[model samples]
Target: MAFDEGDAPGRVVNGLSVDVEDWFQVGAFEGVIERDSWGGLDDRVERNVHAILNLFDEAQASATFFTLGWVAKRHAGLLREIAARGHEVASHGWDHERVFRMDRKSFAADIERTRKTIEDCCGERVIGYRAPSFSIDQRTPWAFMELAEQGYLYSSSVAPVAHDHYGWADAPRFAFNPLPWSDLVELPVTTAQFRGKRLAAGGGGFFRVLPYAFSRWAIRQVNRDEGRPAIFYFHPWEIDPGQPRVAGAPLRSRLRHYTNLEKMAGKLRQLVREFAWGRIDVIAHREALRLEAEKATLHRASA
Candidate 1:
């Protein structure tokens, strides 16, 4: 159902999120770089994160940072900095392990560890999660059950697009409760329908590869036409044009990862300026209240 602007009477507030992981730790490079070797790599995350923080500050916007537990363990101060700036801290898993790559037991342990690490570092409850590379699809539907059980209020792990590596093509394009009995909300990554096709406008490689105007138009369409807040996400590495390039990754991986790195930060600034932004928790609460009100109305009508 299309939400009408008359219902809200203002610009829709979109969600801004960042996946905190180094360039080499990206899923495309997992085949080449072992987790054990990550420590030996140059620590560029601090500088890159600082850049993003500065950008957000300039925009006077708040965002949710879905950070890696492994990064928090090593750079607790960084997570604290994010919280001090008033942005929400959430989990991006203990490491960069994809949900499908792990079994139930392992996935539980991974999220639990990450939650603890983030909470311990920032002293704030980590109530949201976005699986690495949008990996929580039908094959890993149990991931949602685990997320709710583990205290996550919502997840932004499903991308409703067709891709070689990951996507759930038929998933709902807006925020939704995946199960009737579960409290967990599944906020799929934002996509905009264009020329009879649903396109990825929620950032990552799409934000980089596509012209910034395309993303801008897509997000505008979602906000104005659909009247729902769009969830836009990007990686810290996307803004770091000087980050070390991975060697020997497949041709496709290289193109997806390295394209338009230098232009990302500028495009992000434009995006932040163009739209209202909020944390995932804010959207979840609003959606929950709307659902509750709808249920109450239905009950009164039935009575």
Candidate 2:
């Protein structure tokens, strides 16, 4: 579909994304649940994703799935199903490794493995990425340079909020080129100013813990007030309240991971129904291309 066309002036097309990983793969459970044990765990991803696909269908929305290569290798059929249903299939790295933990070589290999796995699974070139846990931050600004060098068209790995685990609190709240002359657009996760502080408005734990009414209002404020589409994301496990709880996780991790799972699917339905949603490439590529053209034009005029 031509996402660049068919929008009225100033219309906001919000992005809906799903981080395609199982409950056991979440960063909160990393220390508690070893990666080696991932295979033995019961697979709830297919069931959960099928439910999500149905929800999107009901809302007449399309989304981008930032799928893990490990999950894609194990659940290729599910990955294919995401593409068949008209959603964009992108990489979420080979494993759930945080970008900050990997050296340059390891990071390159991880992205290549994921890009190939996703392209092979969905038969589409993967151009977008979201780091595990939003791992890209100020110290690892090279992550953006690497993404550009590795042929990524855009990235949604930065969350412009302060967090112990990951965030670049001062990054642009909306999409912008990370490098002055590169085409690689960095679309940070959505945030809204609240009481003189930036609060997480993008979906995930924030979406689960906060009242649905508040999330709805926050997203609307981004679109209507800020005149920019909000980038909302969630995990399939988020909708599976019955999923097994990790035993050894800290109290804080447990609370963050398990809160309001049952309500997530319904809230997602309402969110999609209430806004115009599309794949990230469909929504952000045009802007990136426009910026590149403007830069080239200015360079020529200056020269």
Candidate 3:
């Protein structure tokens, strides 16, 4: 499925998203900083998110904000502002809890609680979810079911690459029905082929660590070569280089989080200007429509 007929022949409206969590809540800091210490830490999320909103506004792009319940509750005004500005407000689990860390029951409760909190803040039903650190994997076969039960329509949760923290290397690279009996879609984050290997092209530490030109080329490859819209995501804290640094984070984590921090916003502005981007809902809707049209065409041909 493509974005619209108005686009130039070889373009698609890729999915751009923001994972709205504070800097202290990152998985990299999970080891060094206790979760209870979150409330006492400096909160840079609001200003950073506003900067992001302004960036999106300036570029005339819309994106999905997969927000944490804890963040949403504390920054209810910011959540309302995000919704007011025409971007989608979706759910990231409460306080950045990874799915693998929670059992089915706790996972279910997390889904319901977070969804309700986000909906209450934004005054809209939350249909999309992205797991913290892309933590949902084959071990949690019940993850999608829990989301389906909570009334989420799609999840941008799985990462189809090998990683030390989280990656389901065998999952499909694009959006697909993870559950045969339900309509919930599992939209794995984007990846690009390089030297006979698939690398993480969707944002995270990868975006910060890699040169901007490579990221541009990789995304272009995904759009032009694969004929599929890519889903790119990054956290709000990515743009805030001035934020307080976590003291005890490991060296590797420090490198991933801190490298190119000052350059992220400029890179993001270029990204917004150069590409066609939209919310996950819009892209997923187009995919569903494309499938329906294909089925109808096949039926007519068979007849």
CA lDDT, candidate 3, residue 219 = 91
TM-score per model over all chains: 0.94, 0.94, 0.94
In model 3, which runs have C-alpha deviations exceeding 4 angstroms?
A: 1-10, 292-303
Q: Over the stretch 1-303, how does candidate 2's per-residue lDDT look in tens digits?
A: 476354456678988899999999999989999999999998999999999999998877889999999999988888889999989999999889999998778898999999998888778889999999999887786788888999998999999999887788888888888886587888889999888899889999999999998888898899998888899999999999999978879999999999888888888888888888889887677667766797899999999
lDDT (Cα, 0-100) at 260 in candidate 3 = 94
User: TM-score of predicted model 3?
Assistant: 0.94
Query: What overall lDDT goes with each candidate model?
Result: 0.87, 0.89, 0.89
| lDDT of each residue in 148-234, candidate 1, tens digit only | 888888899999999888999989898888877787888899999977888888988988899888988988898889888889889
Between prediction 1 and prediction 2, the one with superior lDDT is: 2
- Candidate 2 wrong stretches, greater than 4 Å: 4-10, 293-303
Give the per-residue lDDT digits (tens) of candidate 3, residues 1-303: 233344455568899999999999999889999988889989999999999999999988888999999999999999999989888999999989999999999999988899999888889888899999999998899999989887888899999999998999999888887887887888889999989888999987898889998889989999989888889999999998898987878899998899999999999999989999888888877776666687689899999
Candidate 1 lDDT for residue 23: 85
Q: How many clashes does the backbone of model 1 have?
A: 0
